[model samples]
Target chain A: MIENVCLGQYIPGSSILHRLDPRIKILSFVIFMIISFMSGNIFSMSILILSVAVIILLSGVPLKVYFQSTKYILFLIFLSCVFNVFYDYGEAVFKFWVLTVTLESIKNSVIIILRVTSLMFVSSSVMFTTSHSNISFAIETFMKPLSIFKINAQDIATMITISLKFVPIIFEETNKIINAQRSRGADLDNKNIIKKVKSYIPIIFPLFFLSFKRASDLAVAMESRCYNNIIKRTSIREFKISILDISCLIYIIVILIGVVYCEYLMI
Target chain B: MSALDIKNLSYIYNQGTDLEKIAVNNVNLSINDGEIIGIIGHTGSGKSTFAQMLSGTVKPTAGKIFLYGKDIWKDYKNRKEVYFKVGLVFQYPEKQLFAQTVYEDIAFGPKNQGFSEGETEEKVFEALDFVNIDKKLLNRSPFELSGGEKRRVAIAGIFAMNPGVLILDEPTSGLDPISREKIINNILSYHSKKRGAVIFISHFMEETARISDRVAIMDRGKIKMVDTPENVFYDYKSLKSINLDAPQITKIVSNIHSKGYNINKKIVTVEKGTQEILRLLRE
Candidate 1:
């Protein structure tokens, strides 16, 4: 059974990672992603993976949550390995009928798997720790430079965060639609792929229609609240970067330098 | 045989997690054929989950639902068959409407049951008339109908299936008094004519009192009380303990009964209260 892991929802903790300024966390995630892409050697990537594991442990979430977050990307990782396994140019250490296993292909598969894991881990750590309000604040602050190009950064942040907030609601609405259709004798458990896809039509239409209605209702509510584009926005709570955030940033810079050195100057 | 025999029904949400909560627990209830049972509870009291389980939309964690002495989930085929045996009209049923026209929307259930095209059309028209919707509006888009009309059409869709048991969750919610009356009357008429059980769930005490033959009060995951409307309302202290209310009219008559009149405190609807008050005046 495919687990519906609660990966994207905030876990609500007051650990050091959760208390960091939203801007600092966002900046660190960006730098971490770049480091992940640059660290190709086994030693550097191993260090990167260990650092991400430590971050996950420090986020006050259990190890199961880290694995649960990885479950969603497991299929993609498997697919990438399957495709890369056949591209063998190195010495074939083992041979079977139309199947070849080479040391280089094996290494490539390991690196691909590691990259995917690192990508998910670094982001999931931050995502599980940060609240929706903080995320929007971080994105808005990070995109301030885009305002000079005639873009409404705040509105962009609002739209993104609103969509994120509606993700769970959409899942709940879809489940309700599925059950409603099933009660009407709409059989969705057929083994035939075509039949199963066709069975989803009755559910899809109602869900789409309901989402549009909800959107209009939300718009009306926002209008009633006097939300306008022209007004200068104000936040109820402001975040400040503390000493912990500075130390965390310094640690990230050290790892970033190690990754660049390993990629370029390693003997 | 009972229309439904639910034994030791329990449902836990997010089980085994920190967020685990008992949505419904060890609930036992039996429904006779054609009996209208109104389930009343405060929000989060598990009425909806209980109703959903009855319709087989939700699976009970530790219970069995028997329809007419047959376990509905005995096998996959029987479970699929039972899906049609207990029709569920979810809350805000109007939002489930998606067909191009009212005729198509009302025909969806019967058509899914593999009724012949002619039979499906017949049942659809019959259900329309059952709900007091005019056949002239059959071809109109469901989006074009008024809110009350859409609601009726949604219920009529389920009515067309002609299930042995019908469960409607909050059928008259968010409507004007007259529309609410019409919808309730429509459901009552359908229930009376078919002689099928109807499980009505609502937070509105008066609406439940007006329609249901028996009212079941739910509190925190269990059925706190189940009796006739008169008997249930008589236990006002227990009802208040669960943060529920008797019908407004019943409360008024009961208040008068407490103050000094020979008023019948079991009165639920306004019309009944008025008649009782007039009798006291004439005396």
Candidate 2:
């Protein structure tokens, strides 16, 4: 019953992006975030956008799926761009009824929109290429230093992966609950918001009940499988950063340097 | 007059996409009032999809369905009436019970149809009585009921509406044999008492053979054959080719017949086979 959306969807492929170490992918994502926030000029924004496009193309994820991933948030990107336009100080190109469109504002707004889209696509590409377990391992590796500070890194990573896995299960349970209520003639077609909310009681209550039941069953199953946290846990597939992954990281670093320094030169 | 008339009904899942599947293919079927038909098929054989389509839950991509000589989907506005006329009991329906009390859960369908409060209560009581749910359990929370009791309450919820044609999809799955037998008996009593058509969409060949007046054999989205249980089980070879097994007794009778014994291969149920064997021994 769930629509196939690109969000959190891992596309299976043997592309370079897919084979990259999860640590490298995760590290690269942090670098991308820093660059996105630090980008001051259109040049930097264009560099980030182009890099994102190239990585997506190489990741073997269809362009359509990437767009599908960003489709829902396009409205938010547009809103932020419009908000950015109003906050800019520049010569106005168009003005009407407390709304002003300026050349500088339009330029800044374009960069903002592109940056948001780039951020969304960059993260989605990582998700599409890297499986959930790999990302969890990456998170654990990155947070290893925190273990010295007494943080329970293993438990945190296990929790994140479990929550990620349960997202689809919750959706399925919700669908079943909705269908059951609907079959009993639950009137979801009410115009009143209160009435609609009331109608959802049948769905919401059952969903919560069923999910709790599933969670308990899962807890039992995990216990039986000996999923208790250990001091030194070993995974089936070891992640190693290869030359290909390092080279890709180096190329991204080059783009970051260009984005930062070239923007300074332009200013 | 037929209680339900289905003409060339078909449903396609994920149409116009790479993952598209013909869940239900062109199928023409009709059920008479008070008739009981058990549909047996393997997974993905379109049995459940056919039941969903018949109950107006899933719209058919092609052809038409006429309930009591009226096109059920002709106007589209009468969908609620259609739903009421064709009640559907989904598999694992017990998980749907969210009402505080079993009585309220059973009254949900009747109340949804805008029955008067008294009338809803009357129907609920009658349905509870029909399912043999003790009146003392009516006021208790549905959550507190045993698994079999909960399932009976769920079935009672649909029974309160008293649909003209009832459809149950694998109702007795994942239950003990005694519970399964009780549920089957309850279904039979309900079907017989209401004089309403009942369609059992199931994978249990033995259950279907024991209960159904007519059997519909489905495979790969098509209804391959429909006939009396004895007639359908007579040709066990055709059934096996469709990835279906005949009832155990029928197979044993067929095996005996193949062994030079003049046993009737059509004796599907245990009682019938035993009686036939005893008669042959007496001769």
Candidate 3:
């Protein structure tokens, strides 16, 4: 039941993006995020947008999916735009009863909207292109230095992996609970906001209880399987940054330098 | 007249998308009053989906369903009335019990249907009595009960509504043999007393054969065959081909028959097989 949620759904492909080691893909995504946020001028921001388009093409994931992912956050985008338009102090270009809109404010609002959109797409692409297992392995490798600080990095990584795994499980449990309630004449949908919030009691309480029960069962199952907290946990496939990775890293670094210098000139 | 009649029923989940799945396909089926029918299929064979459609929990994407010659989905507004008339007991339904007392949980359905306070109280006890859940445990929280008891309470919750057609999806799953037998026997007793039509969806072939008056074998969102248990079990070859199998005793008895030990092909119960085998040995 929980499997129905298609957020960050991966599209399998035989393209070069699909063949890249997941760790390299993850590190590159982080660099992409830095470039996206640091883009100051429209020129560099347009380059960032172009890079997203290129990556989407290379990943072989459809553009429709990118729009679908953005659909979930459309409310926030709209809210930000509305808030920036009337509230920001600037020379007025248009006037209503109490609303004053300006070109500068509009430009600022568009920049924020673009930045947010870029952030959403960048993170989602990482999720859509790479498998969760590889991301977990990457996280473990990335946190290797934390062991020196007397923290159990392996445990943290395993926890993150299991939590990611249970996101679907929780959703499934929620669906079951909702269906059970619906069968009892509980109308969750097509109800007013007040009624909807009240309807959530039936869904939420059962889900919360089941989640705890599942966690207990999982803990017992884990103990039965002899799970350990060993830091040097090995995997079947090891991640190694190759020449291809270095070249890609250098290319992104050059783009970042050029974009930042261009933004400086714009200012 | 048949208690429930489903004609050309079809249902699809997430239609018009890549994830579209045909859960139930054009299925025509009927259930007479006081009859106990078993629906057996592998997981995702559309047994549960069919049961859900019959229980009015799922609206068929196509076709018509008549309960007592009246269209069940006549109007969208009175859909809740349909739900009340045809009760559904989902798999692991016990997890839905959240009331402070088992009595309250059982009465919740009846109360929702607009039954009076006194009538609701009596119906709650009646449901408790029907399921054989002791009256002493009625005031206690359902969380304190064992898994089997909780399942019974959940079933009782639906039973309080006294639906004319009862649909249970995999009711015996994930339980001890003794609990499973008790639950099945309780359902049988309920059917006998109430004279209501029952559709028990299960994967346990042996129990289904023992209890069912008619068996519907489903495979890949379609009913492969529907007939009396003896008739359906006779075509063991085709049954297996569609990911279904006959009861083990039927196979053994058929093997015995092939050995010139004259035994009836219609034998369903182990006791009957034993009697036939002894009769053959004596002859």
DockQ values, each candidate = 0.55, 0.45, 0.35
For candidate 1, the lDDT comes to: 0.87
TM-score of each: 0.95, 0.92, 0.91
Give stretches of model 2 more than 4 Å off: A1-3, A76-95, A98-109, B61-63, B69-74
| Greater-DockQ candidate between 1 and 2 | 1
Worst 10 residues of 3 chain A by lDDT: A1-10
DockQ: which candidate is best? 1
- Best to worst by TM-score, what's the order? 1, 2, 3
Record all residue pairs in model 1 with backbone atoms less than 3 Å apart, i.e. clashing.
none
Candidate 2 similarity to native, TM-score: 0.92
Task: Kindly list the per-residue Cα lDDT of model 3 for residues A207-265, writing each as its tens digit.
Answer: 77788888899899998988878536679887677776676677667778777887876
DockQ of 3: 0.35
C-alpha RMSD in Å of predicted model 3 compared with the true structure? 2.7
The CAPRI-style docking tier of model 2 reads acceptable
> Model 3 segments beyond 4 Å from truth?
A1-3, A8-13, A190-195, A243-251, B12-21, B59-61, B69-74, B274-283
Q: What local lDDT does model 1 show for residue B110?
A: 95
Error of 1 at B221 (Å): 0.6
Encode model 2's per-residue lDDT on B185-271: one tens digit a residue. Answer: 889888778979999988888889999999998999998888999999878888888889898889888888899988888877889
